[model samples]
Target chain A: MILEASDISFSYGSHQVLEDVNLQLKPGMTAIIGPNAAGKSTLLKCLSGMLRPKGKVRLEGITLTTLKQEQLTRQISFLPQEFNTTAVLTVYETVLLGRVHQLGWRVSDVDTRIVNQLMQEMKLTDIADRYLNELSGGQRQLVAIAQSLAREPSVLLLDEPTSNLDLRRQYEVCTLIRRLTDSRGISTALAVHDLNLASRYADWVYVIQNGKLRCGGEPQSVLTETLIAEVYGVEARVTIGQETRPVITVLGPVPVASSDFQSERDAGNDV
Target chain B: MQGTTANDLNQAYERLGRRRLAVVVTVVMLVLVSLFLDVITGPAALSLPEVLTALFQPGSVSEATQTIVCTFRLPTALMAVFVGASLGIAGAEMQTILNNPLASPYTLGVSAAASFGAALALVLGSGMLAWTTTVFVPVSAFVCAMFCSLSIFAIGRIRGASTETIIVGGVALHFIFSSGVAFLQYMASEDTLAAIVFWIFGTLQGANWQKLAIIAVVMAVTTGLLMSRVWQLTALRLGESHARSLGINTERLRLQTLILVSILTATAVCFTGAIGFIGLLAPHLARILVGEDQRYFIPLSALSGAFLVSVAALITKLLIPGTIFPIGIATAAIGAPCFAALALWKRRSYW
Candidate 1:
């Protein structure tokens, strides 16, 4: 399936967040790497049909807007930056919610099997009966990933899936994500802040700078030192490490350009 | 090691499942017992045989005893069950839609609007409806309360059905309608004020078979509709955006649940004034006992609510020797403390 977005624009009230954003993807891992407020999350929301944008999102050549909410969900599953549930449901019950679209009033055997398989695959078998409140941040995120995958989506969109995790958990989550996406042949889009992780896992990378798609392609080609410096306003070194992953080391914050800031402010008036 | 872990989990799940089932069944039994106790232990001195005879074989009992059981105890006892179950369902639905533990039909000004409607009818209703104030008051209360909630939900749609929006809208509507009732009280004649005050106190004193039948019909139809959407509702517990991502149209779900909640709450409160606490506490208590799965959670919530109101009525009867204290006040006294304890008690995430 081909997931494509074209000429998409979004604004929250008068503040325009994304403009004329375009992207295309096949079945592979894609990372939307950007600084804070660079419309990475907004673009994902647009593609997921959470927020309607100006143009069109085509999922496998069908206009996403034309599909009903139920029809669209079968093909696409989005995991937001933070999805919290304070209800006292067990981990098994929480993941079972992923099959909500399939279940009737009672939980079917097929549903139970799928939930059990996903929990086991995610290493959540031990905590299956534990309350969601009892889990740590990383564990909760794993549960949420299991939930998103429960629907068996062809396309998965995640917004900052590893932002809250420690170094090891981050690697583990990214590795799990890569393994799942690869095994399932699912096209996955992740909005990530960690550039090295993105370069490591994301087969394709889109570098967004200030709500615009600055550039995109292969990670090594797109995540250059100049692009990182310009987009994040940070001095950094980009190098190929032991493997093929682009390793980024930040030096210091770059001084702000008053002219650039003023011109951006003036551009905001056009919205 | 894996075998032991899986076995332990399976055992734990089974134990918890059995425990929840036991608690729910016990509560249902308690509600049934409370119904009988409520009928038999009234001010009228009816022994077990007399009360049973009045209940089963009216011809065997005296007319006065028959009248006492049929007219007073039966209707009031059943009203608690009907109203309790309805508000419990309403509270569970509201909490899911608003995503707030404290959310309920009463807390969201639904019952207050019903009271205001009843107050308006009492203060200003004329000859056209005077012959059947019973029907008129409830009909108008249902309409006005539905209108109030529909408007709240419409406003909520604009704001995305977040907790703050719903709660703030509820607080605003609550103040408006409650102040409306208070203002009507200030202007009402002695008879009118007394009637309105009595209605607002939320008693089962006025329950008749007819009112019970009407509430029962609405409760059955609405609850059936809600039961069909249990899976969707369970998904809603994961927050609105997540539910939406899972193919659940959260906005439509919120609107549907809100309207149903309004109807249930209005019908329940119109007959019995604005009874509080049951809607707020029942769902929380049910969640504490039986996790957040709506299939069991909703029914348990309904039963818990019925149990609370029925117990409240019995407490009201027992408080004094002869005169029956209003069940609504007794509920506040009884329920508020229980809610406080539940709130203060260190459980895993009350909200």
Candidate 2:
């Protein structure tokens, strides 16, 4: 199923966060990359139906607003940028809760099986009984990913999924997500900060700047030095690594007088 | 390759669940035993067999014995169970929905309102309805409690039912009612002042079959309603945004649960006066014993609350030979140290 968003606009009170943003998510990993407060999270929230934007967002030609919350959640599983819990839920229990919509007084065999299989696939079986609060940051991230997959959703939206992880854990988690997206034929869009990681793992990239979609295409065409200098206000060298993905190396910050920086700063003030 | 790991993980998870279930069952049994002790340990100090015989076979015992067991002990003991269970369930859900560990029935000022109503009847109902004071106090308390909670609900609805707004509204209500209660205390006469203080101290002396039945029905309804939504409530522990992403209407859930908590707290506090600590302490103990899985947390919270109050009732009997101490005093006296110990013992930061 393709998640198609057209003319989507969202605002927080008087401050506009997303303006007429249009995008499509097909089966495979798509990365929404941008600077801080660039409306990447807002766009994903709009696409996932977590936040109702102005225009129509359709999943397989059906308008998202027409579906009930339960139906929408079953189709699109979303993991926010900051997913932390104070509850002393174990790894298995946390994942099992992804099936909360279908659960009754007694947890069914199917729910348990899905949770168990997801934990195993995520290699989280070792910490199945560990409390979520007690786990390491990387381990907790894996558990969260496992939880998102436990829904078996066709479309997965993750905001800053690797923000809390170390460098190695980031690579491993992105690789696992890419593998899962391809193998399960799921449309996975993640809002990421690392441009090179997005270039490596994402089949498609959407760059958001100042509450608008700046560019969207294959990583090689989308992550050019000019696009980075325009959107990020930073000088970067984009080189094709041996793996045929654009590897961006940041050189220095652009001057404060740049037009993009002024617009980004103005947008920040409105928020 | 995944088969063995999945099976092993399944078994491990089940084992943990079974352990939690065992803890719940044990706490339940403890409540029953405490209830029995409370019933038998009154002024007469009847033997176990005597109490049991009087309870089961009324014809076999003397009329006075039957009256003591049936009229006095049974209703009082059962009322403690109902009140404790109601507060426990309400407190657990309150904490969950508000996402605050300190939230309880009293936090919303329902108990304070009830105390004010009881004080109003005690201080004002002197000559006009002297004979009706007995019924009037409880009725006034019930009405005030319901009014306070409904006011909070209405305010919460108007403000969009966000957690901060609801909590702030509750705090504002709490201050308003507490001030009313304080003013009532200031103007009360000497004899009526004692009565007002006693009512605020909280006693189960007014427990009877009628009040017990009403509380029992409310508890059953709220507990059943909360039980049906256990998974959704558990999902909330992951935080509001996460729960919403999982398709939960968190605002609606909070409002509905608030209404249910209001009814539960109002009914529990009206007849019994302002029993404290059990609401705050029971859920924390339940969380310690069994994590936040509402399947176990809700039932265990109720049982632990029942156990705490039942034990407090027994201590009230045992404290002095012939007279009963006010249960609220006994509960706070007993609950404070145990809560401190549990806080010290559990190293995990549940909040």
Candidate 3:
């Protein structure tokens, strides 16, 4: 599958959040790593059809803009950064909701099988019968991921899925997402805050700044000290870690003059 | 080393399925028995044998017994069960769509709006629009209830149709309608005031075969429409964004469910007046029993509602036997305590 976006631009009323950004993705795990408020989530939302951008997004030969919402959603699943489920539904019941598109008045055996398999795959079987309110933060996060997986979508879009989780759980969740992307051949784009994790788990990396793509390449080539210093404004060292993956260790914040940050934002991109 | 086998899932499904079935069957049988008892225990009470004979062989019974059983008691009894069931289903739908456990026909001011309409009609006389050749009181009440719902929706649409917006809008409407009713009571004549007050204190005395038939048909069709989208409704229980990702049109579902709830609440309360707490309590009780699967939750809500109303109907008679109480009084008297207890003491979290 090929998902390509060209001249993609978006704005919230008077503010331009994204400007003439373009990206081409194939079925693999891709990570968009950037500083806070860098428009990574906005780009992902546009690609996932949650927001309409003023450019062309094509899946294979078909245009994404022309498709109906239901059709677009069936092929793409976007999990937002924050959500609180109001219903105290069981884990299994909530996960089964992902297959609602395929099920009718009654849940089919096939639907149940897929949901249970995801619970098993996501290692949520032990807590499947437990209410969502009873689960810890990490467990709930995994359960939500399992729900997204249950859709059997060909493309997965996650917005900072590991933001609230602990370091160990963050690693675990990212690894699991990476494995699912590889095994199922599902195209995935994750907006990430952790540079090391993105370098370690992501097959392709795109560094975004001010709603524009700064660079895109393999993790080793993309995670340079200069890009980190410029994009995140932090002093950092990039070195090879276990499994030959790039590891970034931040030393301190690079305190640029106040005028630099303000000027860059004020000089809005001309789309 | 092995993942959970399909056999395990199959076993769990079977066990839960049986439990659901047992709960349904038990409630249904209880309702059936209560329905039978409710029909015979009126002011002119009859023995079990006489009641059964009257039921099984209506033609052979004396004219008086027949009138007591078939004409008066039977329709009211059936009205209690049907009205309860309809309100229950409507309550569950409101909770799912509004994403608030406290949202129901009464809490959202739909009932109060109807109450205001009924009060307004009585103050003006039922012949306010006699040329229409329809019962103006119920028609007026239904229209006002629907208008209140639409007003809430309009407010929501203008400023993001979120749960909080709609709920606050409902509360505001409740106060507005309540004030309207109070004003009508203040201005009414002595006879008009009494009639309006009696209507406000909802009853089953107005029950008859024709009214029951019309409500039953409306309920059957509306409930069918609701049941057809049971899965989507269940998914909606998750959250707006989650339902959207899972391929549900959240906006459309919200609009449709809103219209359907207005229809249910308006029709349920039009003839009956403003009965409170049943709608709020029934859905919460159903969720506790069924764990939020709308297929079971919705039907179970209906059955539980029927059980509650039937019980209330009996309480209305037995609380002070010589003088019967209006059904709303008994419903509030019974339902409020349970609702308060659940709010205070119930350990389980509903949403």
- The window of 10 residues in a row where model 1 chain A has the poorest summed lDDT is A256-265
Clashing pairs in 3: none
Question: For model 3, how does the per-residue alpha-carbon lDDT over B24-107 read when each residue is reduced to its tens digit?
Answer: 899999999899878878777678777778888998888888887887888999999999998899888888888898898889
Best by lDDT: 2
- Please give, for residues A91-170, the per-residue lDDT of candidate 2 as tens digits: 88999998999888888889999888777667788888888888887787788788888999999999888988889888
lDDT scores for all predictions? 0.85, 0.87, 0.84
DockQ: which candidate is best?
Answer: 2
Weakest lDDT window of 10 consecutive positions for candidate 3 chain B: B125-134
Task: Give the range of the ten consecutive residues with the poorest summed lDDT in model 2 chain B.
Answer: B126-135
lDDT of 1 by residue, B1-351 (tens): 655655555566567777888988998999999988888888877799998998888898889999999998999999998899888989988888888887888888888999899888887774454543677788778887888888788778784446778788987898999999999999988888888888888889889999999899998998899889998998898987788778788878887888888888888988888898899989988888897888889899999899999999988888897878777798888889999998889455656
lDDT of 1 at A49: 82
Expressed as tens digits, the lDDT of each residue in A149-233 for candidate 1 is 8888899999898877789988988898899899999999999988888899999999887788899998889988777767787
Q: What fraction of the reference structure's interface contacts does model 2 contain?
A: 0.88
Q: Which parts of model 2 have CA positions greater than 4 angstroms off? A: A257-271, B128-134, B158-162
Candidates arranged by DockQ, highest first: 2, 3, 1
